[model samples]
Target: MAVSFHSRSNSYPSRQHPQAAHVDEQLTRLRSFEAASSSSICQRFSNLQDLHDSLEKMISLSVTNQVLSQDQIEKLLDGSIKILDLCNIAKDSLSQTKESLKEIQSIVRRKRGDLSAEVKKYLASRKFLKKSFQKVLKSLKTGQNKNNNALAVFGEAETVTIALFETIFSFISGSKACGKWSVVSKMISQSTVTCEAEANEFTIVDLEFQSDKSLKVENVQILEACIQDLEDGIESLSKSLIKYRVSILNI
Candidate 1:
């Protein structure tokens, strides 16, 4: 007897399959995870960048002038410790974000083999977004590492500047040098104001991302926008740090 084979329908059944429902649920969770993690990662980066800017300003001020008051030295030490603590916090947050991404990736991979064509398209888009997000996260990690290295250099520079300042303040304290130092001090003070204003802007941007409702994985354009914003911010931050480093070296 000859056996007959029927063609399979591409359409979903009137009743959903258990596996398909599970895949849908996983995708929904993945969307939520991605949005939350992106917001958290961006906010942490913003805070880290703000701390870096503040520390750079303090380091610049410490070195720009040949002399420093006892009060100024104390402030620099306090600020240095604060920046280190903030860096640690940002690092922890980054680690958490990575874990969250990994979990989502695992969930998707587990169900990917059984996915239907329509569902596969959704998964493929998600994978692309995930890879894009991973790039952003890697950029953030690189930036954080750079910040760590900068912190070390800044700390050493600060130590040398403090020792020199103490020596000059104790021995020379020339009236003309003091006058020049006063002008530098005012410039540093203005830089602090600028740092605060920039930080406020970053906070507003962070909040906007945190509250964003369109970051769903199904909405590819919005997801891409979020990634693009992160890339832009990272580029801006890199340029600013380079400029600050050059200025510090000149001083």
Candidate 2:
């Protein structure tokens, strides 16, 4: 082989190879950094003023940042206080609403109790009236079965009629006082029976005594008839009251 001499400047090197181009760029960057460090001038004069100015700027920036941070913390605290105030107001409103509900509950219970008591009283009064009416009817029936005299029957019926009238008067008075006059009206319209009895007796000696006394037997009979009619009227009223017991008590 013939040896060839080539200049070093024209020689191909691995550093300049295509594959190592990226590595060469890195080495060039490193050399630049080194040159900048080596060739940098070292200032001889005092640069205290410039240093002071830079420090002042840094200090100002730090103080501004601290002020901004403090402002943010204050804003956060204010927001928390506002939220707490709102929560307290809501709690007070809820408490008032609960008290109102309790009051409403009490009113409803009291009204219910009052209505229940009235119904109980009405039922009791109705039962007593029914029992009394039945007893009177039974006594009348028994007397009729025994061939009782008309006078006795009339007297018994008259007594019962009087008792019934008194009872009706009391009921009406009580109902009116309670603002329940409808009860009295119902009793009058629904139930009653008229019972009348007539009897006659002739005495020969009684005629002589009546003439001496200037008394007319016909007048006596007329008066007796009138009294019987009055008793019958009372009986009719009693029967009417019994029939309307339910309606009257309802009022």
Candidate 3:
């Protein structure tokens, strides 16, 4: 929304700055991360982090100065800050989810009364997350106007930044990508589980609990590990975002 749009992604001249070319190269690599079937949301965001580092490096060297105006720079800084805010929101949400899961795990281990009540509480928290994600996602829906030219890197970078956050949030929110099944959906699909719930960690565990009156320790452990891995990925993205913001400030 901050940078100008181009009619074509490759509309720049054949003779381009080497530093800008490097940015184009990084963009290609970022795109490839999704093309590979084995790539997860964490992996996709990892590649995105690298791309920002490259963009920062180039911008620091003033390679993109020819194209970036002071106004554009201000927008870039503001955009980075908004993105960082979203990252923090997502991280906090995941932290809450992890803590809730731990609470349920404790309740199950105690073999205490009313385990269903705990699961329902966890599911309720998860339901709140879905609604929040939906609201934030709606606010971020800028139409597809991405460009890949060296002169257009600033615009393109923000596009990727917003796009990846949408993806990371969608994954946590249990929304499907490109109409495909979410990771949570696939994990629970083996059994004929039926529930009026979205495919997400909370719902998956809820179904598991419904199948039997108690939760499985292994499932809880697996989800915990999975959530931890995602948290690590988010931490990495947050660090990169901070560094990128600092780089912009220096400029």
lDDT, model 3: 0.66
lDDT of 3 by residue, 49-82 (tens): 7877777777777445444545556777777887
Q: What is the TM-score of each candidate against the true structure?
A: 0.29, 0.18, 0.77
Per-candidate Cα lDDT values, in order, are 0.36, 0.29, 0.66
Model 2 agreement with the true structure over 130-223: per-residue lDDT tens digits: 3553554344343221212212221222233233323322321222222222223332211211101111111211121222233343533543
Ranking the candidates on TM-score from highest down gives: 3, 1, 2
Local lDDT at 207 for model 3:
56
What local lDDT does model 3 show for residue 238?
A: 81
Error of 1 at 200 (Å): 27
Lowest lDDT block of 10, candidate 2: 36-45
After superposing candidate 1 on the true structure, give the runs of residues whose Cα lies further than 4 Å from its correct spot. Answer: 1-36, 63-218
Better of 1 and 3 by TM-score: 3
- The best-first sequence of candidates by lDDT reads 3, 1, 2
Q: How far in Å is the alpha carbon of 71 misplaced in model 2?
A: 1.4
- List clashing residue pairs in candidate 3: none
Candidate 3: C-alpha RMSD to true structure equals: 6.3
